[model samples]
Target: MAFHRIFVLDLAGVGMGEAPDANRFQSVGADTIGHVAQQWPGDLSLPTLQRLGFGNIRITNPIPGIPPVEQPTGYFGRLHMAAQDNRRATGLREMWDYTGPIRTESVFTTLTAAGYSVTLAGPFLSYLATQTPAERFQVGTNQAAFQILYDRLNAPVSGLTYVVLPEFRFAGEQQDLEASAQALQMTDQHLAQVIHDLGANDLLILTATHAADQTFGPTPTREYLPLLVYSPSRQAGHALGIRRTLADVGATVLENYGVAPATTGHSLLNELTQ
Candidate 1:
């Protein structure tokens, strides 16, 4: 089977363990944990995704951070880390067994080709980097940026299914987990409003890229992130379990739609759908 719509969200600076429901939303992956984790997802629009075969894509209020510098590479190395996200781990000239757009693009592209209409939306790294003067904040100093990103995704266009995504991992860094939880609660309210505006019975999948371990004291440690699968179609409330890897998002989405589960990550559909 195929899902009529799909959504992929990449959040910002989400560490491996942090926050009230730290397990509910954290980003993991050498790429995410090492590099992209510090940045927000890109501001790719629906038109871009459609051109890339997705029906729609939106990257909302991405975090702020500087991208790594690029370096010259030898023949094979150049072919390896050419993709923006991959360049951080593989470096200038070195090939891993798998070299491709291992970020969100890889998963979305695969689903698109499989006949699933896709939408990508999220805040971008450059946008987020601009938030602070400490360097690497690209999200402009305009409060409107966040509101606009959310507003623009009000509904799905023809031939495309709409998905509003927000990764709230960085919230823990603002003060303490309490403040972070409040922020997440606010974000959840906003997202809930968006969903309601889009119409009742719309499918929703909320996830944390990985986890973080931030404390206001003299200690920190890695922890598991949380994943929530909410489908009005089924009246499902919440599903619990630490997604072991970032690729788990892809796998769960495929399973949700009845498509052959993509060859990545673990599947939580059984727990989520049943």
Candidate 2:
């Protein structure tokens, strides 16, 4: 199914569990979602994510309230950070395959060259917009960011929209489980609207740049990030398994628009569509 629009929601610092090399970074047993769920005073409801296969990523050890459903409406998976450090900048760079100091090439550039209008919205746009050719909307809050995305989706041009939500990250940094739970609820509500507004040719991806498990301390934890994919055109949802690198995301988007990836990652488009 060829999508006319693609939306990548970067839920920054929303990690699932510790990565393979978690001990090397002194972040062993760091699970952002797990800790948040366990400590959330009451039931932490995230119906939208649950329906999108959020709970399917971890079968053996599932999130408290968001258990794996029998039939999810989207694809679920995990992604390992390819960069040595778990910094947001490095994660974003790796996603677009930006390796050089002077970042000129990326998935955004490739999409632009392919005649796809790309819009980037988030509080941390400066970290990425300066390096890419996509239109930038530096929003201070998630509401404003989603508004820009909604506007872009209504626009006539076929394009890609990237949004970053830092609520979870902020809450995690503060080690506030209540705040984290609230952020999840609020974001899930917003996501519900996005899901409802999605066109048949629209694809939505929810992921995180790195893990910021509050249980692991104030610094970013080395952990596996969640990958959730949904499209109105998809017939059924399935597990996408664990992706090796974040670059696979860029590769999938480029392939969707008939563009070759300029980075070092395989595309999951085939698995997504087939």
For each candidate in turn, the TM-score is: 0.47, 0.94
Q: Hey, what RMSD does candidate 1 come out at? A: 15.8
Measured on C-alpha atoms, candidate 2 has an lDDT of 0.84
Q: lDDT per residue, candidate 2, 1-274, as tens digits?
A: 2788999999888899999999888998999999989987676789999999999999999898889999999999999987788776788888876443455467887778777898887776666766466788888767777788778777867888998886766776787777877888888998988988898889999998878888777778989999999998897799999998998888888778877643577888888763
As a TM-score, model 1 comes out at: 0.47
The residue-by-residue lDDT of candidate 1 on 1-274, one tens digit each, is 2223333222222332332332222222212222222332442122211222111111122222222112101000000112223211121111111123453333344445555544433334432222222112123222323354354346453112222223333333332444333334344445545444433334444434323333322122233223334443444233243443445555556566654535545655555442
Q: Pick the candidate with the highest TM-score.
A: 2
- How many clashing pairs in candidate 2? 0
- The C-alpha local distance difference test score for the whole of candidate 1 amounts to 0.33
Q: Considering summed lDDT, which 10 consecutive residues are worst modelled in model 2?
A: 96-105
